[model samples]
Target: MIAATADAAEPDSARQRELVRLVRQDCGSCHGMTLKGGLGLPLTAEALRDKPFDGLVATVVYGRPGTAMPPWKTMISENEAEWIVRQLMQGFPEEAR
Candidate 1:
């Protein structure tokens, strides 16, 4: 099981690159290009330092009901969501060069 996860949990480089684009563009459409906050809350590393990682995952996967933040579950997997959260907490990354 662990081995399976090790092989399948992480999105591939191409998928990861696409995910980054979606997050920066689609999510950033509301979260702000710099993730500094707009229609949604700020997603900066400092902003998320005190946040609950699990809750962040839930929000990404399940989204907040009655809010503009839509669930990205249809487009991303649990591991991918976790990766996104980790990236957000670590200042995220620059767009694919």
Candidate 2:
């Protein structure tokens, strides 16, 4: 039942594309180029199916301390993080060629 903050507006198309590239390149490094699993756990929709949605967003923003995950708050907004989680849960989009 968790939702993105009221102020967290959906990113514009250009930003969405930028976000897609960021996840595909940066996150993909640890989550695997396919997001199937690597140093980090799989990010496939099935893998994240039962996880708390808000937590996922928080992880993207705050990161898991003591782990390889690093906070991306400096790079992306919370709303953008939410968008990424939604994409991951529904099968992440491929980086635009």
Candidate 2's TM-score reads 0.90
For each candidate, C-alpha RMSD in Å? Answer: 3.6, 3.8
lDDT of 1 by residue, 17-88 (tens): 998898899899999988999999999999999999999998998889999988888778778888899999
Per-residue error (Å), model 2, residue 78: 0.4
Best by lDDT: 2
lDDT of every predicted structure (CA atoms): 0.87, 0.89
lDDT of 2 by residue, 13-74 (tens): 99999988888888989998789999999999999999999999999999999999998888
Q: Compare the candidates by TM-score and give the number of the best one.
A: 2
Minimum summed lDDT over a 10-residue window in model 1 is located at: 1-10
